[model samples]
Target chain A: MIAPGKLARLVATNALSNRRRLALHTFGLVVGIASFAFFLSLSMSVRSVFLEEIFPLDEVEVVAPRVGAADVDARDALNDDVVNEIRQHPDVKEAVPRMAMAFPASGAAMFMGQRMPFEAGGFADGVDPAYVADEDFADRFVDWEAEEHEREACGPPPERECGDHYYCDQRDNTCHKRVPIVVSRTLVELYNTQFAPSHGLPPIDEALEGMLASMLRLEIGLGETMFAAAMTGGESPPRQVEGMVVGISDKAMPIGVTVPIGYMERWNREFVGDEAAEVYSSIEVVLEGREAVAPFAGWVQDELDLSLADRQGERFATAIFIVTALFVMISLVIVTIAAINIAHSFFLQVSERKRELGVLRAIGGTRGDIRTLVLAEAALIGVIGGLLGVAAARVGAAAVDFAAHRWMPAFPFKPDSFFLFEWWIVAGGIACAVVFAVLGGLFPAGRAANMPPAQALSQD
Target chain B: MAGDPIIRLRDVEKSYGPASAPARVLRGVSLEVGSGEFVALMGESGSGKSTLLNIVGALDVADRGHVEVAGVRYGEAKERALARLRNVDIGFVFQAFNLIEHLTCLDNVCLPASFSRGKSPAEVQERGKEVLGRVGLADVAGRKPGTLSGGQKQRVAIARALFQRPRILLCDEPTGNLDSHTGGEVIEFFRELNERDGVTLVIVTHEQRISSAAERIVSIRDGVIEDESAGAPAAKEAAST
Candidate 1:
């Protein structure tokens, strides 16, 4: 049983004797570990962005036939009974009914009667104001009134549309001053990418002022006389009214807008009368968490016989994660090959130092001591390589993130980092490296330990 | 030289190859050396003089024998026990001066102590310097074996063998690789060490000149010591001077 001090000294002496070999071993290992860590961190970062920034994990949207089997209108679909049935689900956090206006918003108008038209049609769904105040993402929302003097804090006021009452944008999900119209984030993205270029219009640069002086239009389809005229393209629906744009939400809202439920109730009462307008178009079901979505959606389909749509847009998120995971596996395969090289290098080293080992054995050194000495050298390599790999991975990821932000500023859902190296990742990375190194040294150590003293002494 | 024999071997036999056609190296050989006597084992090439030394040092095991060193018998002792006995009771100086090239002279000297249980590296290192000084190579303690001359390397090897303070010193043609002048110096140094330190010495060599310095010169032929009368008391008195 050699003392640890003596063993360490032996390991150090032998390891340092072949400086060039040790350096080569460590360099290959460092690159392998760095690539592994880089891919692992990248997958985790993208997953985090998908969960935290892209969509709320606990919500789904539902719709059903309104009034009767022949009903083709959203104004009478998914009424109070359907909303109540969904609310009874144990996993459901809230089942807010989506209220629809009798007519869609056609254009935006100023006090001077200047009308700005949207390139395509749109719809306006009304939602509960109280829900937006509670569940909204505050940072992404642009508030117009708080710093009226600081209007330039965001951008031009041509897009700043605030009403005296609540209006849910369903774009950024942040609370703002009340209005009658809300726009979805999908609408904004579509307008910039597909809509702007073909229509010869400038793409939206900032979220706050992009849709200034614009009229989010919808094809009217309500009432007997107005519906007939709208069907014939003779005249627009009589139940039309323009409302200002208000708050933005993170939800993947449908085509047009989101107004307050209270405003919808009042407008429906005045135009269509209470008996015909008390019905809702659809309902939004917010669940406890992602785990509840499956069960709740199952109940809605089986028991209620209603269609539960995935408004969360998680399929794109899944595809992104799967691709990232594939890359991570490829990196690990590279690390595996590098570890094999490490094993080969150690075997060569042991073979090269047979004489030295034999001399030690001849001087009362045991087989265990020689084997331990070799393993200790391997562990030293792991520690140094693991540390270097971690630093290189971090710096490498940061460099890529910096480049991405510089070249593509408008990248959708971009996070602060493209590599999220949490504490566990660091710990796991080092542990993995050490395990690989130990595994690499095992066979060589066994070979050295099993050698006969005479054979070793006789070896070149 | 009044103490009982430090090393005793009775009918020790060693051979290689198949039992039916064995190439016997030692055939029922018996010898004994008393305390503090420098005995030389001499033979021609393949006479098994080195084999005898290896068996005495516990580096090689006799095929059929009763062997004892420092009052501990071999064959019954476990391999580990025998290794421990070799570490503590016998020291070997090989012809090649097998100093580990990577280690400093001091580390090479301290090597034996590191293999022994209950020995601290610090204590071993401290004692290594003392042994190096005794062998007249204290100034080269920090120098690597590669940097040392042939004579210096031999001295370092001698120092390493003496580092653990073993009772018996076994040299297998210790001056085989040195020049004539360095060989003479090393042989004289060995004689002085045996006389002054009172350590038992067994030296195997082919040269009669080297053997003349020892108290007894026993020749091996056909794996047996020459004769019992060759261990006469008169030889001890003549070489002690």
Candidate 2:
């Protein structure tokens, strides 16, 4: 039967009288919340990096064969006939046969001006020339002529079929004349310095754009060619070949020259020597649809009786493991310390307010009422702390991005690339703050509720 | 008009500590107070006067006894029911002026009433102000107890006791912390309340001066009543004198 107004006034008075202690308690909770938010954001960001960036490009489903388990002979591993059979399956939209070989090369001429160790290899993939005509894939790897036409409508009308070097306007459009080899921006910039005058190409500026116009020049052994001379034996027969640079792609290139499937088959027959050229160290296949890459890669491995190993997927897994362990342990320690601090603060608050609580009880407040009042105060603290933590995390994230861009310009922190402020992170942060605050308040609130009114009233 | 007793105790006993080493504060004590009677309980410290007063006020339960106040038996009553009885049937005025210091005089007076009964805040305020005015504290109604003088605090306590219109009022040394002049004024307020409102008043104190104000005085020692006497003014003219 207590009047609402009186009860509210009493609660308000008690809270105001001990404002300093309560504020201290709230501060401790804020720190805990901020730490929890940081850890939560970190965990989510790592997961997003794996799923969005690494997983899509690397293809997670193709399992590699266990090491040293009856290694298949190179001749029997992944033949062109087997690859063609996989492509015939209805679910398989596209299949590319690949061959890889690694050789030693000088890395000194790269753009960074320092000779870094380089592994040179030969890569060949047999693809349907029509696959490059896809509008979506073209956006990622090649700038479509249609898009260029759309951008400049009033400019010079596109020339009709400029031979094998460009797309010809015909009833059946195919990019078969000379497929553009995409190279990394790093390679393009480095090669521009060496061959700019001969090609009459524009000065390479942007890394991604530079990759578009660079070509590879290879020297095979007929007798005494540069590559043959550099080999262990002296005075080998020389063979020189020049490849037209059709298109430069922004994708990171494997440390090797990429040739068309037609060129690879011809070169393998002529120069690689029968026993060495027959075995491929590895192969990379890009499926038609991004979603189909995993299943198709799996199918290819099964058909060839060969295994696929994705270095990117393994790297991502290692990154997740290291990051999770480090952050989770740090967060656990921070939150535990904060919880203890909050508990001590609340204990002191209750002890100091014994008389106030006694007065409330004497004035007809039940034990339930006292407990509710204490819990409400704790909840309020948690809410404020949670908001502060979120704000701090956002500010910290911005500072981190800025610092990264300034310090590591080559690998600038890409804001859009990382997951930030995901829904689950926010929800979990708030829940953690509240739960911690409650845990801190439990013992103190219980003691306050059970205090003898007579003794409490008698206390000074 | 004479009526049934408002408070009754039969063989009430209260002990402290464990059974082997228990110290009995009250042993086989019995007493009664009629409706509208004003009685003063006089005893030295530790003579069980305060314990008896507490038992009568329903603030504590006797270890072995039948204690009844306003027709409710204390021993069998539930905790909530006892609280209800304390809230509505009995009003207490403590010796040390146990006014909630955070509250204004009017709010302090009205708290028990607000808790025990259903009344709008505005109504409670109006009633509280009226009671304060009755105790000659209308001007200080907004002042908290901390700022008020001792006598003023006691007046606020009395006002709070009267606001609920209880059947019995228990005062444990209501003027103990005040000066002689302030204490006399407080006693007068209590006397005025007893005479004008027909409220039963039970005062526990060792002060001889306060006994003069009561209609009857009972003295106790060693946990038992030693003597009982009518007040001087009533004794000579009464048949029981």
Candidate 3:
């Protein structure tokens, strides 16, 4: 019948009377909770890197097997018909087909007074605009060649009647619009972390990256690269193409560049053949949710006779999940042992306070009151220990980050910190602490409540 | 003793230990004390005087026959109902002055009211302070029992017992732990409370000086009442005070 507020106050007062013992018990609980929080956060961070940066799991890329590699069929090839078929599936949100440049190509760019050149023979691919439609720079990533009905002519090669965001093509002696291209965020990270430092260039940070669309431009040689020059014969004269960086995306190719598919069809037809323009290299199928991934991937392989380009994301996800669960179980075992210690401590406390409990009974306290008092004390300990545990985990994460920065070697896609402390994880850790502590206190509280008042009073 | 008695017992019997070899502590003893009366139960160490007090206060159950206090029968009562009966209708003062050592004296005094329903903390606290003031230990309310003298601790215990204003205050050798001078002072406090507030008192003791202040004395021998008699002349003088 005691008021809840007063009962809480009474519990606080009783717990405060034994500060040293409570602190010692709480230390054990904090260690368990800290280990749980740290392991969970670390797993989440690692999983994020794999799922978001290295291999985006929500979208699966299905590639047709090479001719004669499998039981080959004409229908098994990835083209517009197959793309439309995959797009209409119940679980498939969208299916975007991609065409790789069938001919040799290479590119060079000058940035911050440094000329960086790279070969892109089989790396460049043309992606459907729907793939990057969600990006912030989607409006700029369109086929400029298709938009221009007729080429505009002017005086000379370098000086032409080109419009805004357009340039002159010296090969055709006409004003040709610059093609918009996108590169993967992973490429930029690699440049900033590994390539820039080795080449003595200023690393591109977020501020410089924002200016990349206007500041960096590349001259792509469509044919007759260094590799193509080594061929026997049947090579065309190289034509110069200009492209401007539009935006970075996870959907872009990791090692090369991605332009709108319209440019690919035109260039492939002009350089290779009409067959090369019609046949797509791959199709990226985006599902509505992760729950549809397994079934959709199975359908892609079985019904469509296509293979997923990468299942490493899902495999890595599963592996990270299992490791996280193992760590959490170990943490739970630690917490359970701490709870057992708490029970032993409470038992000792109840034994010591037997006469006081009897006096409370003599003064009209019910058995339920005694039980609640003990449990409330346990909950208080849990809250204190849980909060301290969260703090300790945060400190440990910072220390690890500091040490990693000082001692670890630079690598591609290295995260800023290895821990991701989300609100739910911290709250869940505290709730677990409370639940474990209450479970530990149950038997001791019951024993205290069930003691006979007269016999307890008779104790010395 | 007039009107219906506040406490009634009929042929109560009690024993302890295993059923194979029981140690009988009370045997077919019946007694009653009227409302607002002062009575003392006198007995030897193993004569069951304390056991009888415990049974009457709802702290123990009688093994046989009926026991009733403040119109509630103990035979058919549940533990919860018995607890309520003990909380509302009876108070106990112990020989050890058993205050919870962790709490302030005021908190100890408010213990009974803390367990009762429908009273806010402020109301209970105000009443606790008033009871401590009544027992002349108001200034020591913030002090722990460990900081108080034996007489002061007993006063705090008495204040806690009176917090609920129970109709019957049961005392089991309340002055047993105090020196003679302090014991006399506590006995005088009980006499004043009984006379001024019309609170019924059932005190268990073997000390003759403590028994002399009661209006009636019942002596027990070998787990049964041997005789009953009037108190000494000090009872009349005590009543006048």
Q: Which candidate is the best by lDDT?
A: 3
Candidate 3 stretches greater than 4 Å from native: A67-70, A73-76, A148-171, A226-235, A402-411, B1-3, B233-241
| Model 2: CA > 4 A from native | A1-12, A55-58, A61-68, A74-338, A341-351, A381-413, A416-419, A423-427, B1-3, B102-117, B120-144, B158-165, B231-241
Per-prediction backbone clash count:
10, 9, 0
lDDT of 2 by residue, B74-139 (tens): 888766666677677778888877887767888788877645657777888899999899988999
What DockQ does every candidate get? 0.46, 0.33, 0.65
Error of 1 at A80 (Å): 5.2
Clashing pairs in 3: none
Model 1 lDDT at residue A210: 33
Candidate 1 lDDT, tens digit per residue, B1-241? 5268999999999997799999999999898899888888887877878778877876667889899988878878766666676677778888888888878999889888777766666777789999999988889999999998899999999999998888899888888889889999998898888878888989988766577677787888878887433333447665776
What tens-digit string does per-residue lDDT give for candidate 2 at A1-460? 4445555565566556556765776666566666666766766676666545445443322233544236644444555555566557655545454444322222212222322233333332222234445422342333232232322112113633344234332323333233334344445545555445454544555443534333222222222234534542443233433233444433334234444444444444444445434444443454455556556656656565555565465566667767866775676566666667777887887887777666556545566666766765666566666777767777776776677667743331133423367876677767777777777778888888888555565524
- Model 3, A326-351: lDDT tens per residue? 99999888888889988898899889
Tens digit of per-residue lDDT, candidate 3, span B80-160 = 777887787888899988888989999999888767788877888899999999999999989989999999999999998
lDDT of 2 at A411: 30
Regions of model 1 farther than 4 Å from truth: A56-103, A107-126, A129-177, A180-260, A264-300, A306-321, B2-37, B45-83, B86-89, B116-124, B216-218, B221-241
Native A-B interface contacts kept, per candidate = 0.41, 0.26, 0.67
